[model samples]
Target: MTLYRATAPHGVRPSPNIWNHTSTYEIENRAVDPDGQLAAALREVASWRARTVLDLGCGSGYHLPWFAEEAAQVIGVEPHPPLVQLARRRTKRLPHVSVLPGTAQQIPLPDASVDVVHVRWAYFFGPGAEPGLAELDRVVRRGGTAMVIDNDGTRSTFGGWFRRGYPGVDPAAVERFWASHGWSRRSVDMGWRFTSRADLEAVVRIEFDHATAEAVLAEHWERHGEDSGGEGDSGLSVDYAVNLWWREY
Candidate 1:
């Protein structure tokens, strides 16, 4: 969603990738986040006060400000220049926040410097994310925790859409990879709720195929604000969960 942060031939030129759909991705970001589930769940585990944090594949730097509010310093590494620029612009006033152009596979951070490493949908979950994992081991300090949040494509309300989007993505294998690495998990529920039906439909269109998008838009998940049966994903209805995995050295 941080298309503005993309640079060079990749950022300068448009990408067919969903992240390139900055507008829809932004809508999805707002729609998917109901009550700050990920943030709240992370807070439940531990506090980040005065800690040095790194956000891998940080998008628009939306979280950098929050990290700055509590941590002594927060650094965001993003490969996309537009997102890097946008993140930079977003956290320009926050001295503790810094956004850099980078990727998870080849992190630019020094060894054992980060107290906490947080990555969401940014980290690639296929069979080849090992380099990123090794880099995670390299940058995170001892006793520090790293949380990698990926979509639970195995089962959920919107699970089918995710499966269809990335047909070969194996959720089970990803869990196994993290677990074998000695990371523990904590599942947190989250959902998507859009104020406008149009916005909801817009987000769905970008998330799935036309048929799938229309089908999702037509279903009434739960009783929303004003209307009892509306054409939008309801926060209370969708079964959203985040797998918070961590480890300590």
Candidate 2:
């Protein structure tokens, strides 16, 4: 079930996949980064332990509890009212974690209020996200770190599918955008391992349009017939590449 608002807030770009297919999106979340490489990389740059952490575009508050475990204070900001409600419900028991209704272009927090900012697969995409970057600059204190994670469409099995799905996104331009902004990029290799083929297909369908999803699944099936057993026992595993863009304020 999806919730609808008569008029969405300004600067809010609805994500239909997550908004309409929340349960399937949850499965996608579970299937991503099983190795914890992204988390490890974030800690290596700036540890959030005992510091205030802001999770931008934190949908359904999936990662809020994880941050709350180490961060002295964890704030999850999302623009969608339904998602904001879901996030609040998820972190209701955690005193250190708070969910707020806000967008990347206009965050609700005060200046220099956060020590670390985590943005994963959110709206901080390259080129057109200057407003969000400005908001990041305003909220992240001096010496604080801000991390943005996005798919590296230059490599990996999932990368190939991503490139095909969104032909407009240029890998070179994206890299240049981050470099020009003084943000450093770290390429991390991760993998999606699903427990069942049905789970894998469901996640892929939400990620891409119908045709692209079908083609991707067909290619995947050809490459590794049922149960290609490697790192993933279920045989539905795909290598994924991601760029971790970060900067110290």
Candidate 3:
């Protein structure tokens, strides 16, 4: 019944798009990276100013404006039609920004055109992302930096929940995959701080399968209930770990 079901690209792997619901995903974006630490670090390393930047899998273009503020030009590529539309609308006023419907496997940009490429919670995770990585090799210019921000499911409370929700994922294997690919990892503490229990629950619901979501929520409540005053408290914070994997070519 989701809008993405009809318009999603064929022969593409399903992303961790949180049940394909954009509204909840927006709440998640707001709850994450409250201090702008991730952005600051990325800017420090990539230094996109006066350069052309590409945001692959840029759903809804949430970070496009920020990139446009510094980059000489910004391009957002997303496969989901509805999200691509939203991204275009979000950046309509920014003449230096463009949002196009495209998948990571087939980025709609010229070879060696981008100075920096960024993918956040998108593709280029674990197995089955070889095609996208190849595409990155083609699109990014020589000396360009490619950055991928993904959950480091090896440590932290949020990582524990992620491991419980998806037992099939091998954190060690994922780490090795990136390490073998010539990418360097930088651990980032981009935790989630929700303003209300409703926000927290909603995020959990989308993050996991129905049964897993329930189990995770129950575990969270049971562990923090007493200190949080029997579930009436609106605040919820989970220590999270993420890997900022990047490579300079």
Candidate 4:
């Protein structure tokens, strides 16, 4: 049974340039969740053993290996064909993992088939994700958990940049959307620390537009803590907060 089907919105998606440059996107992904706070947050809410895991928008499969380590079976679903191919390549050596070409509105999984559903940055934002939300309801069985790791761009130091980048995204409306749909949220701080300055610059480029990127770069150069892992010498990282929404149905 499928609760709701997913389809790409009429005109909103990451630019092809963004999708085409897969390596850059991966750098940004690595930088965003450097501390794995999202995973830890989900585990804190509920634990699993030999559970079935579904990673929506699994990208180039950067985190699949980690999930495969604990999950008895792991399935990664991504809409982009190239990314799906990349994800398949990433997991070729892991017998317990599989990658599929699909989207959130239409998760390529059976009804009530998964024990844990995990997504980061790639899923959830505001009203547009309602169908996808319903799909979650269908796939996550009773006692199962769905975790969405997205930035609470309303708070945190980088919040300003995020909010500015997407001015129309009302955080208030987003909170309402999730709450109305029977999901609960908890906020936690995570960090992203890159080992090299070049890696840091590459991440910034992927995250912001050219003008904003230039502005961010200049501002950072003027201020010394820019490359300091967003926390001075604390591994040169930034404190990122994510909203973990889950429901036991």
Candidate 5:
């Protein structure tokens, strides 16, 4: 029951899709990585159990509770005021979980404050994310690990769609950017599974522009036919690939 706000935070880059259509974004969050492959990969690289975890750009605090279940302390930093309030309200009952108003470029926490920093689809895109990366270096302890989850626009069904939707993003250039920065990447194959076709459509619409959305949905319809949610069809599922970028501080 979270409300959406039109007023975006000043001096912070706004995520238009999520800021404008929050409920739909929530559905997208639920629909992503249903098998928990990303979570498994993250734990394999750096386990947050018993450590202080920081969730950067934790929209609506959806992942905060999950991190709170294991981490000794969970801190969620978000620039959007409304989202900050939502995160705080969501984690109000959790004594160890705290949601703070801050941006990745200028994190409010002190130096070497967190053990594990988890940033999923947030500010760490590629070349322009150096400031955020610097903040991570400052906040993460000596032995801490920082992980950034971003769309791998090289392979997978959704990768093709991503390339088509955002033609500006070069997968090779992004790879080089991470490699130059000394961050290791593990490309993981993940899939989006929605319970209903309508839900799938809604999620896709938000992820892409109208033309791209229509084209993607039409392609899906053509592949799976009108009755796509049937047993024979792949139903409301899409093969998505993501790069789990990590670096030890």
Candidate 6:
């Protein structure tokens, strides 16, 4: 009786982050993008106010409440079972918000059903995401906008760190793929500011592979010092760069 099985063939795709470790991912979300730059970009693309919005891979429905504030209806689609349950609980108070277990490859929505689709730091990563793009064409109505936000691992301190951890990801190539497909890009300056060294380390550990996480942490402490800061506080901040890709149907 799951809509996900019908939409997502070959089963659910693997997620980079450990959504099972909810606390770790939550800290990561809080630590990143303290500024409202990403939200501003989304607003500029398409105001969800009074419109139907689809949040693909909306783990735990973190941003569902914000979208529900203005959107007439908000659909949060996540493949993970526990995360889906958590998302439902989180949005139980908001009648307009509904969470479903699904994948980006096959969105469980009708044709031309949504007015605005926003995907931020989700599973529609770089290459081999054409299926999701096809779904967008089917679900997004005319004049509707589809936006995707991802880390620009090409420049800046955060980019450098990401490159060190994931040498396989080619930011330039990813940009090219989007451009070739007629998606426009906008660069945003975001950053990670953690309250404590433990917080910083915890977020990093989830972000990268085990070996890469250890290496990155070692390098981080080496550059920033073991104390994180000169004083007693263990706070750390790193400037991050991101790319916002969008297209209109």
Local distance difference test values of all predictions, in order = 0.71, 0.88, 0.83, 0.74, 0.87, 0.83
Query: Which candidate leads the pack in TM-score?
Result: 2
Residue 130 displacement in candidate 3 (angstroms): 1.9
For 106-201, candidate 2 gives per-residue lDDT tens digits of 999999999999998884457888888999989999999999999989999999999999999998999888899999999898789888788888
Off by over 4 Å in 1: 1-18, 219-237
Model 6 stretches astray by more than 4 angstroms: 1-11, 229-235
Over the stretch 1-249, how does candidate 6's per-residue lDDT look in tens digits?
255346544536655474546878888888777888777878988888999999988988888999999999999988878789999999999999999877777888999999998888864556778878888999999989999988888887778878987788888789888998899999988788887787888888878888888987887778767666556543488788899999999
Candidate 4 lDDT tens digits, 39-132: 6787887666688988887878887898888889999987766678899999999999999987788887889999888887763445678778
Which digits, one per residue and each the tens of the lDDT, describe model 1 over residues 1-249?
A: 343534333312233334557767766676665778878878776667899989987887767887888999999987776778888998999888888887777788899999888887764643567777888889988878887777777666666567766677787887788788777777766766667666665666776667766665556333345463355434334555556776765
State each candidate's clash count.
10, 0, 1, 7, 0, 0
Cα lDDT over the full model 4: 0.74
User: Clash number for model 2?
Assistant: 0
Candidate 3 residue-wise lDDT, 1-249, digit = tens: 355666666545465553377888889988898776787778767999999999988888888998999899999998777778899999999999999888888888888999999889874455667778898899999989999998877898888888887788887887788888888888888888887777888888888889988987877878876456335553487788888989998
Better of 4 and 6 by TM-score: 6
Would you give me the overall lDDT of model 2? Answer: 0.88
Measured on C-alpha atoms, candidate 1 has an lDDT of 0.71
The TM-score, computed over Cα atoms with residue i paired to residue i, of candidate 1 is 0.82
Per-prediction TM-score, please? Answer: 0.82, 0.94, 0.90, 0.86, 0.93, 0.90
> Which is better, 4 or 6, measured by lDDT?
6
**lDDT per residue as tens, model 5, 40-151:** 9999999989999999988899999999999999999998877889889989999999999888888889999999998888743577788888888899999999998999
Q: Which pairs clash in the backbone of model 3? A: 143-249
RMSD in order of candidates: 4.3, 2.2, 2.5, 5.0, 2.8, 3.3
Candidate number of the best lDDT: 2
> Candidate 5: which pairs clash?
none
